[model samples]
Target: MGRQCITEVGLWLPSLRPGVEEWQQMLSSLGQLYVQGVKVDWLALDREYSREKVALPTYPFQRQRYWVESSEGSDKTTTKHPSATASSPITELLDRGDYQQLTAMLSEKESLTAVEVVQQLIHLHQKAVAQTALRDCLYHIEWQIKPLDVASEKPSQDGQWLIIGGEVTVTQKLAEQLEQKQQSCRFVKELPQDYSELLQLVQQETELPLVGIVYLNCEEVTSHEEVLSQTETTCQSLLELLQALLQDESSNPTKVWVVTAGAVALGEHPISVAQTPLWGMGKVVSLEHPELWGGLIDLEPSKDVESQMEYLITELLNPDADDQIVYRREERYVPRLVPSSPSTSKTFKAEPTGSYLITGGLGSLGLKVANWLVQQGARHLILLSRRGLTEETEAAVAALQEAGNKVSVMSADVAEITDMERVWKQIQAEEKPLKGIIHAAGVGRLDTLEELTPEVWEAVLRPKVKGGWNLHQLSSSENLDFFVCFSSIASVWGSAGQAHYAAGNQFLDGLMHYRSSLGLPGLAINWGPWAGGGMVTAEAEEWLAQTGLETLSPELAISALEYLMSADQVQVTVSQNDWSHFKAMYALKRPRPLLDLITVAAERVEAKTEQAPNLQQRLEVVAETQRSELLRQILQEEVALVLDLPITSRPNPEVGFFDMGMDSLMAVELQKRMSKLLGVNLSSTLTFDLPNIEKLEKYIIDQHLVGFFKPETDEDQQEESFLETNLLAEIEQSSDQELEGSIDQILESIID
Candidate 1:
């Protein structure tokens, strides 16, 4: 068959050859010829290929393999379960109701995670097994649970230390004492004044592992220029040094202590005015990176250093120490919170004869203050602004003049020394002795730290720092009855985006102290946002409101100012805030110790949380038909509260809120109140977006209350949807007259 096929097909298979090597060589040569582009036809073998199917027997077979014997014990009954062997010691202690033992074990266990400890405590509390004992145990266990996985308890073995600006005799004495205690120390005596050079030095010095201590010694300034220059240089140096230290990974110091000789504790002290910035910056730096901050020590320059050395050394060694600010006394040092008390009287008198000079006096706040002065029996008033009198301010001035007071308008820049000098000369020429000065001239710029440039910072600081300095210098010997520098709460609690503004206000606070020390009458009022006027822009007012800051009314603010005029305190912060809301919003990033001062607010928040269901939960149970009416009442109440209007006089639904005297500050307050009441996250511009009560009500019902009232079943949901669609279709199909009637009915129901 193969030979016949080969002859017919002109092909032959390799099996036809007797020698295997010869046939393989022949096939290889043929394949090589094909690779060389030679096309070959089919090759047939000696035998023909065919396929056939075969049947198999169907049978099941059982087979088993022998298992290996256990390595330790051949008997399975002698072995224990894996779960029994893996039981945790913490679990055992907890199950035994031995909370004391559990806490001790947790404290000593190096391998146990904080999560495990927390879980055990939670389980014990949930089970209601020895509740009081578990609570006490949990409190003790909390101290062992570190927030960050840091080696906080580990002491630094490196003895080298870096001390900046400890050239003062007192600090030098302390340094000598530390050395005598066998501690190695190095002092950078000639501190760099420029920020760049200081940064470079910090980088170089921090490259090696060493603790850093910054000392801000009190220094006297000969002139206003010197005060500004020194303060600016010191602040810049500190800021740069902090930045460098934060970025240096090779030498992450356990703690950085900032020591200053100033009255940082809430009080009036005159000699350490320039040193106040250190305190403010120290506070903010600590908040920014609590892990790296050691503490802020404010020493009395005259106090002996020998007694405090032990406490200081303890603070340096203990990274987890709490008290951030300390002040020295005769025998011991203590922490202090700046205290503010109400004024003794509801009203106070201003100088009757001398003119009251108000910088930025043409602005809204300035004009209001002018009116206040006129009412306070001042006959002469000087209003200073860069653009002396715009059409609006001109009208205000005319009205003030009509009210039987002499109003003088000056076009001059308060920040410019020449402009300020020129104005001072004018005040002197008027023959009305400058009995009082209100340094209200300032600008507020909201920018993040990264966005702050030299120009932006200078713009904000110039009016406050330079203007305050100029006013202070020009009126130092004027025998003024009162020198009030209008500051802001930003200085007290650092605002998120107002670093420059806060720094500027802090300088004012410091300057007030300086004046107080010299027996000069001075007071710095750290006022919150003023309702209807001042440096707060519309955007700023909205942001402040959303953050739970309420604006002070003009009447209340003026009354407070009048009372403060006779108060003995040099610096006081005045504001009406919703502490619960403020804390919730502000503490989202991190906790603030300053907020602890608002004990009343904290108590109120706790009470609210315990006493009430949150707005969302309350709204969820309300019927859909009743929600619109409920929202209307809430909206009206909030509006009345914000606008300071009578609740009975609900404004016409068709009228715009802005037309009804709702300004930016009021709008923000209304938005916040509505959001809180409705349990909805409303926009800051809700009032603007909706424009009136009618539109706002419809928007709330449509957007927030859509699924607020959940249906009990799928059938109910479908029925509700069908009804809503049919109602809409019927309304669309109805005549214009019928639609008007339906709208009137709805409005009447909501309004009623």
Candidate 2:
């Protein structure tokens, strides 16, 4: 071979050194020989293999797989090395840092060369890359609103202000503040419930062009009725007002500022979470109707009326795009997205002192989190959802329970505070104070601006915003290590159709900030489209692909979350986007300040190597003899991409995918790509049913393309032709007497 860079030298070789055990020494020696293309005798180890067998596995065959080698079968061959010698003392070895001596220590038995250590590291890095492809390499884009302090600007560009839905006292205080600044204002005690009337209120309330509309209607909630009532004020009311403002013929551009007192938590002060929905919706409105939309202003809960008014006036008149503002004391705060690095630290251990509560726990996302939580040492779990413990969810619950966890399944809505309170009481009664709350309860459908009916909007908002508030209110006193909410990327950078969803997720981000401000444990993850069964429909998923948005694998998304929980972050957006494709597509719209703050989700650009057409189409032209091989090549290419291997390094046609670092999440990913490629909805258990490329290829052709194309020769006729052509040859190896006896037995059976 010409001189070429050899970055890696080991593939199957295991490093060998002094003081190693006999079984491993033999294994490593065999591994070393195998890489050098030396074949070992397999029959020589047959007896040893037989001695190691004790019992069969209980789970389904070919389902379970992992990286670490098992020591179960090593007992037979495990023994102290006969000619081993102890290496130098570790301290002495460190002092010298001798390359050859260190190698000698690693492979005392074989005297492993220094080159082997370098080779092993390269080999291990390959394994590390494979593992990262499934875990460390996964990330999603998130928009964090980092707080920036600034001096208040003087009032300029005066216009009349519209104030809607506030108590008489607060409204009067605000109106007086506007008057002192030479600004005319009007106050509506209660916003009109009807949409047409909201149109009229905006047109009739202020005579001249309005400077801004301030809505301060969010209040503390005590029941489900109040949750809906508050959402109507914060979400529905704002929706109607923005629509009316846009439809009016001559309404001048006015910033519609939503002010909520004690609605968002910045420190540990009380939060009127009922107002939080406005923040979620405000972000959406900022995108959908930027001209008519103002920004979100969260006022602190305080009894000092004069102080509150002074700050409120200062924020309203300040000229800037500081839309997402929070006023606490004399300080003015705004949000910016800061790039974050995910941690692998062991600091985020799930404390077993208190039970974990997962709203929407029966849903797929909730269950995934619950399973991860258990793995992190959580002992007690309360899985609360509207439809709790159904046929499917019950099985998952049973599995968690069988694993020695206390899993309580409750069929109650998290949106209903009473229900959550009842669940809280039961947990407290067991002396397990709630340690963490995962507010995953959310429901939404894709709809354009016109399609976002009041009913549709409220239905979507109820679960996430109202439910999040309920969790926050009920768990205020709990000794919790984390209060995480599952937010969507739709809010971070507005989704065209999902205005309400963006709104709900926006509230989650605000809630985390509220918690952070108050010195409480909180995290809101603005997740991108997820691969595992999430809200993204097949059509939507296809669209996502075209837009260069990668669906987040469940394994990666959850692992990223566990790491982020330990991070000092109030909010983080996790999304997988091909920066090359995403930025190109996103450029169709005006540049969003939020997108500017996004660090590229991943440095690894998606490989554009899948050139295979529909399998059936490819099979139609290929000869029958070559069909199996052709399909195998195509499948192996797909599998290799998922395994993060080079295309030329196609996996063995007969080796298992799971054995090649393809976890269930990767399996899900492969199934998705294969489904799209072949135009068939493959089952999620596709990998298990057909364990290897050979089996998978055969299954695909047999099941999907059964009669789509004709074989060159009929299979049945080919078998008959074989028998006809080789009648004597078929029995040539059999003894004459045995053949005669077989004929006589057949004749006797026929006669009987």
C-alpha local distance difference test of each model: 0.64, 0.68
- Which portions of model 1 show Cα errors greater than 4 Å? 1-161, 168-186, 193-215, 220-225, 245-256, 263-269, 288-293, 304-311, 319-324, 330-340, 343-346, 584-591, 601-752
lDDT score for residue 477 of model 2: 89
Q: Write the per-residue lDDT of candidate 1 for residues 1-752, one digit (tens) a residue.
A: 66865676643434335565875777776777667766565333323646444422111111122577568632222212222334445557757989788777444556668798896564433333222111111100000111221345455454545566645565666667656655566566656555345545655654445555645455645466777786676666666556556656644564667766553533343455565666565655554555556667665555554455665665565544333545445223433223345435434676668899999898878888998888678999999989888888888899988978889999998888899889888888987899999888888667655456667767887788888888888898797989999988777766766767877888888888778878898888888787775677666666676666766656557666776788777777776565655655544334444454444322221222423445445443456654555455556655666787665445667788989898655665676666665655555447756878889878876777676643356776688799999998997698766776999997787556
Q: What is candidate 1's TM-score against the reference?
A: 0.55
Q: Which one wins on lDDT?
A: 2
Q: Looking at model 2, which ten-residue stretch has the lowest summed lDDT?
A: 76-85
TM-score of each: 0.55, 0.53
Error of 1 at 284 (Å): 3.2
Candidate 2, 44-136: lDDT as tens digits: 654635354332222121122356778763332112211122222443454787656645545334655768766654433333333344332
> What pairs collide in candidate 1?
266-338
